[model samples]
Target: MTQDDMPRTVRTLLRELDRASLATILPAEPAGWPYASLVLVAVDHDLSPILLLSDMAEHTKAIKADGRVSLLFDGTGGLDQPLTGPRATVLGRAERIADDRLKARFLARHPDAALYAGFKDFAFYRLTVDRAHLVGGFGKIRWIEAAELVPPQAEGLAEAEAAIVEHMNADHADAIQLYATKLIGRAGDGWTMTGIDPEGIDLRRGGEVARLAFDEPLRAAGEARKALVALVGRARALP
Candidate 1:
């Protein structure tokens, strides 16, 4: 892919991957030290990374003290040479937020977190992204500004996202399954819609997940039905 296409690639990596390595500055006597840990992650409507952290965790405590952080999303799994695969480093400041829709989005991607999500010490935080660095194999690297990394604001669709996800999983299970098996070429049973955004739909069945991107983004809630129906037609027509 060219440098111009790196932004979309970064967004895909952020959306499809469920976990990342979170790096935070240590808040101690020698304050400039760096700490890294594994973290489960999800993205908000505008592609900002969302994290659920506990006040007791070292990273969380560090974030409270100094919100500046970096998250590494590695897409090099199973590759013979890891450096020859796609990966991204997102640099930003993480601040705790209290938004139900975003929390639900995170939970939908990570159902197991629902168990401890309500604990008093656990809270949600979003990365206020400054920029990202993408490494797409050899000779394919680029720096993506926050504006290019995230799509334009889609307030109408954001407000309607939960309802859309519920409606698809509730009333259109067959269509959703087709989307996974036919459109995305992933053959799996019990596939269901986990989240929907302007760019694509996130699907999961058991431990596996997949993303099916729209040909064109839906700018409003009213556009979703028509776009989804068109996808159904396209999936059905595939031989």
Candidate 2:
């Protein structure tokens, strides 16, 4: 398959995941070689990857020297049959971001990170994605340009995500439940709306994630609220 044949669901998967295998340039004597490591990740309002790094970590040291990197997200359960499931590689440059909201967004997804989030040696970095390669399965592969996957600037979303999420989780608890069980097919009362972007809402229950995508991308909080109402309408109608 080619980029033209790529499904929107694939992009949905990218937004749903919070961890990735980051490959960065090794800066020392192993100069020309690549180094890969697991990283906990989050997505910014524009869908770019956010990373929390420590100044003392090897990868962070390398990133400071050469920002260019790639993050691979795999979906085969474990790595037993790594070739059988869908995976994606994001190619980009990882630069430091000082946004407090993005940091909060990340902490919401990985609360344990809060322990070290304030460490003097730790900081946040956001990847400025250039392109992505996705392998959905055998013979199902494509290269996607960054623009096709990220949303354009939405001022309201960037500035008010915390309040928007609070409103949804507080007032629309039932709708959130409907989305988790009926629409996206997940179980448990632990369903919590972890994050929402122009493309979709991220649902987490006991730390397991499932994304509920909007029929179309949204740019404003009002638009997102309307989409939630419509989606709940459809979810209620489900037999």
Best by lDDT: 1
Q: What is the RMSD, in Å, between candidate 2 and the native fold over all Cα?
A: 2.4
lDDT, candidate 1, 62-175, per-residue tens: 999999999999999889999899999999999999999889999998888999999999999999999999999999988889988877555598788888889999999999
* Tens digits of per-residue lDDT for model 2, 1-239: 46564645456556778788999888997886899999998887776789999998889989999999999877666667778678888899999889889898998777789999999999999999899888887888888888777564545876777887888789888889999999988888868787888878887877688888788788676687788889999999998
> Model 1: which residue pairs collide?
none
- Predicted structure 2, TM vs. truth: 0.89
TM-scores for all predictions: 0.95, 0.89
**Could you tell me which residue pairs clash in candidate 2?**
none
lDDT, each prediction: 0.91, 0.83
